[model samples]
Target: MARYDAIVVGAGFGGMGAAIQLDRLGLSDYVILEREADLGGTWHVNRYPGLAVDIASVTYSYSFEPNPYWSRLFAPGEELRRYAQHVAERYGLRRRMRFGTAVEQARWDADRRHWVVTTGSGELTARFLITATGFLSQPYTPPFPGIDGFTGRIVHTTAWPDDLDLTGQRVGVIGTGATAVQLVPELADVAAELTVFQRTPIWVVPKVDTPIPAAVQRLFAALPVTQRAARLANTAVLEAIMVAGVLEFTRAKVLNRGAGLLAKAHLRTSVRDPETRRALTPGYDFGCKRPTFSNRYFRVFNSAHVRLETGSIAEVTAGGIALADGSEVALDTLVLATGFDLWQANFPAITVRGRDGVDLGAWWRASRFQAYEGITVPRFPNFLSLNSPYSYSGLSYFTTVEAQMKHMGRLLGELARRGAATFEVTERANAEFLDRVTERLGTSVFYGGDCGSARSYYFDPHGEAALLRPTSTLNAHREAVRFPLDDYVYGGVPA
Candidate 1:
């Protein structure tokens, strides 16, 4: 078995960031295990039409290796993939990475203090393991009646066939998430007729996208300090605005209503048809599910070729989709915008052990996977989950990621310097931290029973909110970044 000091899982932004930091800190003995054949994670897999980042392109890059070559306000998937590959090569991370080798299960070698890592090829051992396998890695397709028997091409946005063409065919697109938002408009132009099956409506915003000029890109690259300062300023301003929108501490119900009203006005202004505009508009509050934007999505309905069905897809027939209203739609192609099992899809790929033969999944399952401060969990010693559950902020994912990772790095560094074998968060510390998180989330509009759409993944099974962090990114950042060295229980994995 091959031995290493650490093992990093997944090759997405989080994992790449982790590996880059580890190597820069002189921990290159670590290996990054990628399930796919290449470095890009979601970016590589998702190649559907008109796909682009909803966030601004300028600040979406890594703070360490800032890229100034983004061609648009919203960078497309391919450019991001190239950027990932470029960053990996630049950092010399590809040398230590093990592509196409997935860690099936990792067994903790308790007697010797190391992880016996099992992959598709063989087994290896490592002193430490990092679960950078991000919040959304796995694509989940819901099982529908006669789905396999459908006499049509079936495709998932996360796993699109690059060669597959939809020209002049009748298409059935299901689920109105980000993928459907972008693809529906593109498909409208090509398909003879398109039917969209939406289980619930999501808030749609206009994506104000524009291509960045080559001159601007060159100028930003030329002045590193200017780029950094602009990024910091942009980050701060957006975060402040978002925090105010979420918190009920000072804002009135009228104010919250006003924000929602403003979003509605934008929708009406872009989408000319009243019926078409209302169909695309969400009945729920903003940020119930992550709001998506595409200038084309709303206007796509104006095309006589497209039809949006807000009714639930009762089942899939051989011909097409069976709506809840006993209506049948015909199609030659089917696209599922049903998103990945975001929070818990990677549970099967992981094998984590804690004290007394305690299984991490089982412990987490018992608690329904809620973590303290959305960072630490009881029993999982020295295990750090990046962008973990409930810690995810829709407003600024990158900022939260960098701040929390920097904090985890500090604790890991202290443990390494002290020769500590293992470290686990104490139960009391976690309980107190979680109380604050849950309390803050309680008052947010996401949990306010007013907005009516079917219970979303943003809410837990028992009707508790799950998707967002507490109001303030600054508060969450400070809580995560300013960890006291004395609070962590330290012992080496080999102790």
Candidate 2:
């Protein structure tokens, strides 16, 4: 058994981020357990034809360690991989990473006030367990009747096999979510014919993407402060957009419709055929399910060879997909661009036994997965779930993660320094914390109060989601960065 001060699960941005923050605080006794061999989490896995980030490179990176080497305004998969590797090397994170070690379970031990963590290898004990298993880590594979019997190759966008070639073959992609928005364009040029099955139309913003000039890269590399300043300036602008989308934007769904007038112009501008352009147009508000920004996605439908079929998928046939409306589409290949099963797989394949041997998953399921500020759970001591709800939706995950991590770091450091054995939120404190989150979520557009007529995850699991921080970016920064520790009453075993 190897003893350690703390153990971080998953090597994604959140896990690596937590480890990096731990390093900055002069804490060395920790290890990062990664399920994969490489560092990049989602970027490492999803290598489909047209994969890139929706958030611009300006705000997608870390504030403390800015990468001066993004090839494009919106980075592709390759550039993102390089950036992650660069961060790992620069921060000395490579030596600390334990690859191919999947965490199976974690149990809280009341006697020692530590976590007994189980991985693929063996049991390891640590004072704390930080799970960075991202929201999109687990892919949701819907049951398709004849999926396995498909004569042609079948692949999910998340696990695209590099060997299979899409050239000249007829392809049918299921699900018109973020992944399909990118894939349709890339496959349109190669495949003889392509058809996209749209469960629902998603709002698409015109991505004003351009290659980064060499001179600009040199300028940022030479003057780091200027780059930081630019990031700050851009962050400030996006913050306003985040707030306006959540609350007081409009009285009815017409606000989003009127707001999409410019998007219509861009759609009409990129797509030539009036029918194709109208088919691509969305009747929903922006920011619903991570607003998609694309320049080529809209134009892909104008090629005359591609078609967007807005029908539900009934099942997969031996030859191809059968639509819910009794239509059969033939294809040589199928790609699942279906969105991830985030927030649903919050606890799976891992038995998290919290205080008194109570399972966190059962607790969350029974209580509807509510958390205290989306950070702390009521009974889980010295445990933190990274990038929890309400902390998301800003689009600038870098800023949001840093803010939350900073607050967690402060809590951890205070505990370590004071020799505190265990720390968990009290029942009253957890209730009050939820009050703030719910209040914040209510003010936002997600409560179905305004902005548009489209239903979004901002409402609930019943389509009435109650998530998102109500405060502005600056206010969120202040609260997350400089949160008061007094609200949390300290409790622990004797030193």
Candidate 3:
């Protein structure tokens, strides 16, 4: 029955950013509801072996607040958790956080001009609701037949147990995505027998991960600008690959081809056997799906104890797994490294009923997935979906967060100026934004490249790769700050 100015349905970086923006706008009476026992979102939830940021540590963090003391170029998962804690404490956000509270649904109440959010603990109302639940928050475990009958221990990477140990046990991993790539190597080192079931091969380039010396850390801490320069340099490289190579695929195809060749060369040198190498090599174009940087993933297959199985999974047996080719792999433990269910479980992580009882999930499924400026939507007054279509920009998630923060600032600033109780994007504006993004995507690899065989989660069930913004990071930033204010309709105040 409690009410506030706003309620953010996550505690991840995105939600943290939203809360920070709200505070800056003088709307500080907000609460952050987190499902887990702690903060850090993914960093708090995922604790599997070899968990680290794929993007370089220097660039992966917030441009405003840089962590100069990262142990390695790619900071470990623990470091990220610590960083999240540091940010929360620094921003005084801990007092506003409610842990162990999972939001079930949020509905707009037209009469009250507020949002009613239903959580496990109780219901709360707020003038505004921001769903910052990350895109990869939901873990997907493919329903292989007889999976329930499996007598052996079955675990998903997202829900990894703390006490569980794979040492000296026969283990089977059922994925080769980024998480699997990091985990398979660790499993091979301990598991007595290891079998990897890869449905689609992933494109991996060599990771230049090195330790940051103490002196370097001190220099970065003392000079701050030095870290900024390093971050800028790394951002440029990522932009070249994401913007130039992928987004501008038609004009800069050679760059994409060059990246593909580099991954191929890395694969060729890492694995000795031709057949194993071929099995590991991806057939799709580079940047069709998100790629990872790893020095150990391809080399792990060289171990005699590790076996790669590319056959279709028929079902899970009591002891192990059965392949469609009548082959069987017996194991003591089954690990489902399958990634997140984006379109189905995510997009709108929780049930959201907007104006006129329009369900967000059903509307996106029936039509195309979209959001105006990746924040607002038509018929969804005073709502901001941080993890929305065409929102993600560049390689680092911080880029996306900062851009959205700017968007929130502009929109809320206007609302305050107008003394409006509610603001909703017009349908015409939303359609125009969606159309512009879709047209621009025509030149991207998702539309022009051979992505059919890639099996990338980037493409939703409707076959629209609307996850990433087709524009450059700079452009996204510029547009966020300069979008037309008239696109949104403000109400609940005198003219």
Candidate 4:
């Protein structure tokens, strides 16, 4: 059995960031267990065509480790993967990582005051357990009737096979989310005929994608301050948009409408057919689901070779898909762009047994998934769930990571100061935090707007918005960093 001071599950951006933080704290006894053969998490796994970052490259990167060599404003998957590799190597995290290891279960040992984590290879005990498994770690595929009968090549965006070519083949892509928006345009030029099945229309604004000029890259490389300025500028713009789209401030509705008009104009300019444009427009609010950015997605609908199907899919036939109206579209290859199962499969998949055989998954289900400051739960001692419920404050996840690190860092510092073996947030503190967040969310666009009807994954099974934090990025950071330490019970087991 292997033992350490800490064990980070998953080697994605969150996991790598946590490992780097621990290393900075002079705590060398830690190991990163990654399920894949390599790092980069989503960037490494999803290799579908036209894979790229929707957010600006500058803002998407970590502030602690900035990359000035991004080839474009919005980076491709390969570039992001390279950035992850660079961060790992620069911070000396590659040596501490255990590749090709999947964590199966984690049980808290009350007497020992440690976590016994079971993996595919063996078990390891750690004083602290940090889950950086990520929200989109698991992929979801809808089960259509007669799907097994389909003889054609079928693939999900998350599990795209390498060397699988669709050139000149009749293809059909299901789901119109962010992934499908990027993919349809790329497939338009390759497939002989393309069919897009849309369950709900997504609002897509123009992506101002441009190559990073050589002079700009050189300037960024020469002076690091310029790169930092660019990152800040990009983050400010994203935050402004978030305030308009998600928050319900005095002028928020007006700003949201203005943004919607811009998206509508872009759609109109891209597609000539009024009927096609109407079919493509989203009925819900702009920020109901994650708004996407693309320059080629809308134009793909205007192409003579592409067709959009909005009717209900009655069933999937061996030859093709059959609609409820008895219409069938033949296809040689099918791709599912359906997103992920975060709350259902991803979070609950790991068997976490806390004190007295209490299951964390069952508790979350019964209480409608929550955490204290989106990091600590009541019964889970010396554990942190990074980027979990109500943790994400801004558009970019880097802010969330930084905020969580601040909170966790303070806790660790206090533990050392008191010479404590373990700590856990009190139930009162958790409930108070949840109450404050819920009160703020009640007035937010996600709660009062048409978001509930949009079927976005942001809302849980209980129709409560458990994904995004209701406050500004700065506010969330301040709360996490400076909140009262008395809200937690430190040292020894609970009575």
- Which candidate ranks first by lDDT, i.e. highest? 3
TM-scores of all predicted structures: 0.93, 0.93, 0.99, 0.97
TM-score of 2: 0.93
How well is each residue in 1-495 modelled by candidate 2, as lDDT tens digits? 887778988887777888888877766789999888788898898899878887878789888878887888889988888888888898888898999998888999888888999987899988777778776677877787878888888788988888878899889988877788888889998999899987667777778889999999999899988788878787765765676654434443455445466677778788878766666666655655456778888878877778888777788888888988999999999888876665454543366888899887677656655665566676788887774555664667776677767777778767767766777767886777667766655544565543354545454453435456556656666776565665455667533
Q: How big is the positional error of residue 384 in model 2, measured in Å on the Cα after superposition?
A: 1.2
lDDT of 1 by residue, 1-495 (tens): 888877888887877877776765666788888888888777777889887777776677788788888888789888989988998899888888888987787766666777777898998877667777766667778889889889888998888888988999999888888788888888888899998887677676556788888888898899988778867776775665455555452344565566567768777877778877777767776655666667777777777888878787778888898888898898899998888775453453476665566766656555765666666667666566664657675365676566666766777788788877776777777776667777876666765535457446666544566556765666766766576766677874443
**Per-residue lDDT over 1-495 for candidate 3, one digit per residue giving the tens place of the 0 to 100 score:** 999999999999999999999999999999999999999999999999999999999998888889999999999999999999999999999999999998999999999999999998789999999999998999898989999999999999989999989999999999999999899998999999999999999999999999999999999999999999999999999999999899999889999999999999999999999999999989899999999999998988888889999999998999999999998999999999999989984568899999999999999998889999888889999999999998999989999999999999999999999889999999999999999999999999999999989999889889999899999899999999999999999999622
Backbone atom clashes (below 3 Å) for every candidate: 7, 7, 0, 0
Off by over 4 Å in 3: none
lDDT of 1: 0.73
Question: Model 1, stretches more than 4 Å misplaced?
Answer: 247-255, 343-349, 449-454, 492-495
Q: Candidate 4 — which residues are off by over 4 angstroms?
A: 249-251, 493-495
Please list the C-alpha lDDT of all candidates, in the order they appear: 0.73, 0.75, 0.94, 0.88
Candidate 2 residue 484 Cα shift, in angstroms, is 3.1
Q: Residue 287 lDDT in model 4?
A: 83
lDDT of 3 at 135: 89
